[model samples]
Target: MNKQKQLSEVTELWKTNKKQYVKKSSFSAYTLLIENHVLPTFGKAFHVEETDVQDFVFRKLESGLSHKTIKDILIVLKMILKFGAKNKWFEYTPFDIQFPTEREKHSLEVLTKSDQKKIMNHIQEHFTFRNLGVYICLSAGMRIGEVCALTWEDVDTDRGVISVSRTIQRIYVIENGIRKTELILDTPKTKNSIREIPISKDLLRLLKPFKKIVNPSFFVLTNDARPTEPRTYRSYYKNLMKELHMPDLKFHGLRHSFATRCIESNCDYKTVSVLLGHSNISTTLNLYVHPNMEQKKKAIEQMFKALR
Candidate 1:
């Protein structure tokens, strides 16, 4: 009988094979998941069964991991198992994992229009490089990483667009038993994320003068060669909100606020999806298209009137 290999052994083999095909960011993510979650649970096992995976899911849930995060971990786990099976290191079994039904809908945080306007006004008046980054986010639905990666060359004043092609993130790397963190400047989250969003007139006015003289290679947020990572920027944003006496919304709420305002203005969902660089229109719809009570009543009234 062939000796069954330990899961940890197969995992190292899989990583070596997987690294060549994936982006550095993706490879880093896979490695982190394996090291932090998968290896800890199943490294010593020769094979994992359905019950083992299901129990792991429950434990992850109890530890307050989100459903999406658990699902991502499972995707990595399944790939490792498949890799092991392909190499004849172990027998592979597919598991059916179940999650508790969610009774309450997840509410995304967003800024009220008045509050959004107040913040924008403040940024315009009290302009700083960091404050300008917040203004850009509100005007253009840019993620923190994307904003961090922005440079003067990406801002085209003549075309009135901001080109989004890259993002900056700190990733965990493990090499020869040494773990360290790396800050990477890589392509944005996905292909669709590499897009040009039209610059709003107000933001354009704010940027046009700077475009003339700023170094093309300088990062927009810093106006220097050094780029700010998301962690530092997020902390800056938190303090700005607190100083403004506004609700402590997460930095992502700036994105939600931009999308919500677009929807409220009755912009077409497909256009909003493209501007937001969503991979699919369905994602945009799901996040921003919830009908309010007034809309439901109005819809019913119009339906009855048409029937009559």
Candidate 2:
């Protein structure tokens, strides 16, 4: 019988082969998850038992990792195991891992109407290129990376749209016992994420005069060939919030604020979903749609009326 290979050995082999197919950012994420979590737990094991994995899951949870993050780690582990099984280097067993039911409902952070208006008014008055990204995010619901990647050429004043095609991110790279980070410009997260968002009349007016003067190839945030990374842009946002004296919220809250305002305005779900570039309408509904007491009462009344 051939000797069983340890997970550490198979991981190195799998990574080498997988690197050829995945995007740089994805490969870096897989590598980081493996190095930080999977390898440490299962590195020497030739076979992983379902119970062992369940124990790992519990430990991770106890350590305060989110279920989503722990599941991502498991996905990488499974991929490596499957690769090993295909090559007859290790035994693979399908595992049914379960997580404890979460008691706390996850809530999205969004800016209040007054706060949103205040920030927009401030941006309009201050009007710097960097500040423009924040305004664009509030109006268009673009992700930080997508906004960071935007160049003047992607903005169409004539057409009244912002083309979202690319995103920028900094990812960790590990090679030969060395670790470093690289900034990469990559396609948006999904095909759906690449779409055109119509510019509001107010935003279009703000952008019109500047559009003719700025170099088309320069990024909107920096107004330069080099783009600002998400981390740096986040720091800028933090300072802006402090200066505005607004409640502390994540930069992602701008996106939620846009979606919330759209739903409140009675915009159709499908249109809102498409505008947000969600892969599916369900994602939009799940995140943004929650019936209030008034709506719930109306629904119950309508049901009773139908029964009568």
Candidate 3:
């Protein structure tokens, strides 16, 4: 059969499988990979060989995709191949793929106690939308996307809780030389991400005054009545810190500060993990559980004292 025939057959099978099980956003991302990258290279590779997959990966690497993004693309491709195989569309597979020995995301970078205090003081007094975003992130340990996606209705002043259920993303899709913008609102990354974080009672009191000024139907941190963009927040916060003569940190560093404060205050690992909406305890441990010499020395000293 010709390349067009093979592409059509695979595409139809993929369309059916996508409809059956995958989330709309997930399936859309997969379809984008197939259309943009995979089809351009492998459209002619009938029953794609393993070398075809390797060459495609290398070509993408040369095109300057990050290791993580490339890895995710490969995962999507693997899913497509598996779907094709399960439905008996292809007797052979394309992916005998392996990854580079690349480093994962940087370990959580948090602030010291004094830095937290400095930032908090500035945000509380010289407030802007960026400060509001920072305050919510620090106090609630909210992800940046969740913070951006939040509507004012999600805050319960009576209960003093912030509900984190939705995430916002800006996606650009290339279709027939037109780049379309898709502003998507979807559930959080994991089941654990759908949680309520209790805000500090003082902050609840502070927010009560703003309640009178806030638009009930709009997103909380928006400059006007639209959803607040994260890049703008990051830029604004950078300027805010400089104006206040404080050290620079990303908007997410506030979240790291929250988790660190909880861990230092003798909160258990599981409690900290849940409060931070981490899917697993290992994430908590990896961030905050490294033992120090001071802690170890105290432990050994206490052991000897107990024996005496």
Candidate 4:
């Protein structure tokens, strides 16, 4: 009979094998989650029972982790467990974890039309390269990292489009009992995230003069070889909001505002999903396409008309 191996042993082996296939950012995420959450609890265990995982979920929830975050941790945990099973180091047992039903309905935060207009108008009136990132995010719904990663070369004024291909983020690295964080430039979040967004005529006019003067390789936000990271850019945005006397909102609120505006303008859900670089239209509909009472009434009326 073979002796069972600790999960930590299998995880180290899995890490070495998995590192080559995944992006650095993804591997870093898995490492962080494993080190912070999984190792302390399950590293020494030769077998992970379903009850143990369920308890871990409850404990994480009690510690104020969101369901999504807990799920991410569990995904990494499952991968390690599966790897252990494949290598004959542990018995395979599928976990069926459950969570208590969440009662509170979460709502997305977005800027009001009036506040959005104020910020846009202010940026247009006092144009700067850093400010251009804010404008592009509002107009094109680019994520902060995507806008931070943008280069002058990505914006084609003649073609009237902004090509999005990459994103920048800081990630944690752990090695030999050492921990450090570093910024990395990598491909977009998903394949769908590599997309082109049309530039508004106003934005094109604002960018035309600079297009001829700036180096094509320079980042759009910095207008230099160096790029401003999302954290630094977020601080700038917060200060701008303060100066404009706008209500406090997270940087991602700009994206929500753009998507909300598109839905309000009667844009088709699929087209809006594509424009926002969503993997599928269902994500767009689930997030942005909630029907109001008026729309529901109209839908019912249309059904009666069809009956007639």
Number of the top TM-score candidate: 1
Q: Return model 1's CA RMSD, one decimal.
A: 2.1
Q: Please, what are the lDDT tens digits per residue for candidate 4 over residues 1-308?
A: 45678999989999999999999999999999999999999999999999999999999999999999999999999999998898899876998999889999777788878888999999999988888889999999999999999999999999999999999999999878799999999998689999999998889989999999999999999999999999999999999889999889999999999998888889988889999999999999889888655578999999999999
TM-score of 4: 0.94
Give the root-mean-square deviation of each candidate in angstroms: 2.1, 2.7, 4.0, 2.8
Give every collision pair in model 1. none
For model 2, residues 1-308, the per-residue Cα lDDT tens digits are: 45789999999999999999988999999999998999999999989999999999999999999999999999999999999999999999999999999999888898888999999999999999999999999999999999999999999999999999999999999867899999999997779999999999999999999999999999999999999999999999999999999989999999999999998788999999999999999999999998655568989999999999
Instruction: List lDDT for all candidates, in order.
Output: 0.93, 0.95, 0.75, 0.92
Candidate 3: residue 189 lDDT (0-100): 66
- TM-score: model 3 vs. ground truth: 0.78
Give the Å shift of residue 167 in candidate 1. 0.3
Candidate 4, superposed: residue stretches over 4 Å from native? 292-308
Q: Which rank order by lDDT, best down to worst?
A: 2, 1, 4, 3
**True-vs-predicted CA distance for residue 203, candidate 1, Å:** 0.9
lDDT (Cα, tens digit) per residue for candidate 1, span 1-308: 45689999999999999999999999999998888899999999998999999999999999999899899999999999998888899889888899999777998898988999999999999999899999999999999999999999999999999999999999999888999999999998689999999999999999999999999999999999999999999999999999999998999999999998888888999999999999999999999998756568989999999999
Whole-structure CA lDDT of model 1: 0.93
C-alpha TM-score for every candidate:
0.95, 0.94, 0.78, 0.94
